[model samples]
Target chain A: MENTIITIASGKGGTGKTTVASCLAMSARQTVQFLDCDVEEPNAHIFLKPRLTREEAVSLDIPHVDHNKCSFCGRCAEICMFNALAVLADEVLTFPELCHSCGGCWTLCPEKAITTNRREIGLIKSGSAENIHFTQGELQVGTATSPPIIKAMKKTIQKNSLVIIDAPPGTSCPVVETMEGSDFVLLVTEPTAMGLNDLAIALQVVRVLDIPCGVIINRGTDVYSKVETFCRENNLPVLMKIAVDRAIAEAYAMGIPAVEAKPELREDFRKVLNHIKGVTAGERTCCH
Target chain B: MKELVVISGKGGTGKTSIVASFASLLTNKVMVDCDVDAANLHLLLSPKIEERHQFYSLPKAMINREKCNGCGLCEDTCRFEAIKESTVNPLGCEGCAVCSRICPENAIEMVDTVAGEWFKSNTTYGPLVHARLGAAQENSGKLVTMVRSQAAKTAKKLGYDYIITDGPPGIGCPVIASIGGASLSLIITEPSLSGIHDLERTIDLLEFFGVPAMVCVNRWDICPENTEHIKEICRKRKIPFAGKIAYDNMVMLAASRGKSVVEMNSRIIDEIIKVWEKVFEVLCPNMKL
Candidate 1:
């Protein structure tokens, strides 16, 4: 079997993206590599319960000024697009939190007074839980950036194993970083006004990334047919519909995957996996 | 004027719903939606746009291929991997302008790209401020700051007593931008493990920024034990536990009809009213409800 990556995402938070991603990993027959790319508030670790085997700190290069060699030229501050640096009459001030570490200031400094230093922003933890190999990024509290941490975490992707990514909510830079190189994207959303609104925005993002995608209507009910109509009109595939079941909610509150609470749901998850496999297989032959 | 921001570290915990309810109940206030990437408050409030402004956050590097020799210096200088074969991928670029600065042939120029749009609208409740970020755009924190400052100016000019903001989810840049210098923040959470985990982190963030905070569990009945745990944590932290709302289907029903839960004739409305009173008392100590 070819290596495949499936990312579960939603524009709105708390739409069960983590639930679906973890359950799919638990039900997969292969050894799945589960990457929780929601660095800001990762919740998959609570359900996966992976015994972490390794920990690594993720850092970014921030500019540090060597004032002794510096003339108050203010060139470094002028080249910084993020406004991370400011030139004063006597000193240069740097705000590391605002810096994107683009290396523009250090590279452009004529006086050679600027150098880069590492600032730790987050951590990457990797472990295993049964057939699932889990890895998640933990962003430091009060840190303004998350895409760099997410990019660091994605470097651990295994080549031979099936990969499942639980993406952060919102269609922004961090969410785009998570879904960039995936083979299939499963968007989880509920059937509500806000849900439909956010789902449309998230679908637009997937379209911009040009990734093949499908929708999973969580907490599904017939009362809200707008999501169904939207998907139909957009020619998007509705892969699965998970009803609003109290038992599943209870299980979720207890840190149990929906498949574990109701064993029959494992087969449903397996079928979703199979369907993705079928779709990707055809795409590989026709496009790749 | 006081600003009360409604946020959830984890998404889908009824932050926007609760804010909409506050809008329906409170007078003399401006409502701001800081979730620029996925603004949902407008769905419930039905804002009629009175003013629209283009939001330009950071400039993107545009190559003037006509002036270029095909040197790869720009590609090598870019840390974002946005340039390939002398073509720039706007989605990959962070708009830092490093590539344009390092181009030996002077082929690259930084151009201001409109990242999103902010709107000033009139809703049934009052004035509302919201924004929509372009697909795959960065600098949401900047856009959030723009909407909030606009709301503050509106509130001050109109003599509004409060600014009720619906904040974005997660404890990231956008969330940080929403709660800074606010009078108080109400964190709407659920009684799930994920919710508790995120709540603790969010409380820590608020504390780090010295922002007074309160917690309210939206579906507290889903897990009574966890709700109690959350209450105990709040007590230990000396943060106010506003109140708990029961699991009610009317919340969803009202949302389906683009109405706030407070507009519906459900017992949940009373509970939400109690939560509002608690938050209001904190925001305005000398006022009578």
Candidate 2:
């Protein structure tokens, strides 16, 4: 079988994205490469418990101006889209946190005074947990951008390995960055009104990206059928339904993967993986 | 006016649900939902859109094929790898305008694109401010800042006493933009290991900004030990600990009905009311409830 990249994302937070991703990794028969792309508030590390053997600082280049060489033309500040640069009568100010590292300021500088300086925005940590190869990104607190760190983490994807990505909540840039190149996306949601609402929005993102996707209803119950109705109307497959189990919630509170807490769950997760493989395989054949 | 932002470092810790309940309890406030990415507050509030404004953030690069010489300078100079064969992929482009500046044929134009939309609406509870960012759009922090400033303006002009904001999850740009300069922040956390871990990081962010913060553990009975651990950490850090809310399925039922827990008849309603009272007391020490 070829390598498959599966991303678990939810439009709302705390809907069990990490839970599903980690459990899926543990249940996979072969070695798995797990990337926790939720840099801002990465919780997969707590669940995966990978013995981090490597750490690398992810930095972006921000413009560093040399006053003696600068003509104070203010061209760099004027052209900056992020407002990271500002020019005063005698000095120029650069806000490194606000810089997007687009190389606009220095490249456009006529006086050649603006040079690049490395600003560490986050760190990428990699290690292994048993058969699972784990990597996660930690965005520096108060840093405005997470995409740079997420981009750095994606660089470590090993070829021809089962890759599972735990994406951040919400349908924003960070989520988009994680789901961009994935083979299949598993959207986890609950059967509640808010869950149905956000799930619809997240589906919009998947549609825009044109990726094959499915849904898993966590804390599943018949009390709220809207989520199921929405999924049926959209023709998205319901891969798995993990009912509202108190033991699972308790296990989660103790930093335990649901599959580990109840070994029977491993079979359920494995079945979900098979379904995904079949879906992706069908797509590849049709394209050819 | 004092602004009280309810934030949870972890998503699904009941921030929006609690805020919806507070909307029913609080009389003189304009509620603002700062979660522009996938906003859920509007679902519960049932807001009637009163004012709508297009939010323009970073400018995206647009190529004029007629003016292009096909020199491929724009593609080579682009750092984001956004340009390929003189065509810019909107998803990959960071909207930095470097291609426009470096284009030899002057074909690229930095065009202002609407990233999202913000709205001022009237709800049964009171006035509400919210926004919806376009799918796969960037600069959510900018859109969040816009929603907040609009809320503040509406609050001040209408003589509202408070700006009750429902903040986005995480300690990122959007969260920072929502809580900065706020009078107080209420960090809602669940009684899980992930919840506590995220809560500590959120507190560090609030401390970094000098924003006064309080802690409220939702579904505290889910794990009593972890809940106590969270309270101990709050005590050590000198942060006020708001009341704990018991785990209840009724909250979900109420949400499905588009109602706050306070509006529904359940034991959880009183607990939520108590939590709101504690937050209100800290927000307005001198004013009467």
Listed for each candidate, the true contacts retained, as a fraction, are 0.82, 0.82
Q: Provide the TM-score for each candidate, comma-separated.
A: 0.98, 0.98
Candidate 1 C-alpha lDDT tens digits along B1-289: 8999999999999999899998988899999999999999999999999999999968888899898788889889888888899999888899888887788888899889998999999999999999999988999999999999999999999999889999999999999999999999999999999999999999999998999999999999999999999999999999998999999888888888888888888788889999999999888988988
Q: How far off is residue A152 in model 1, in Å?
A: 0.7
Query: For model 1, how many clashes?
Result: 1
Q: Pick the candidate with the highest DockQ.
A: 1
lDDT of 2 by residue, B123-167 (tens): 999999999998888888989989899988998898988999999
Q: Lowest-lDDT window of 10 residues in candidate 2 chain B?
A: B255-264
Native-to-model Cα distance after best TM-score fit, residue B44 in candidate 1, in Å: 0.6
lDDT of 1 by residue, A53-132 (tens): 99999999999999898898899888887889999988999999999999998999998889999999999999999999
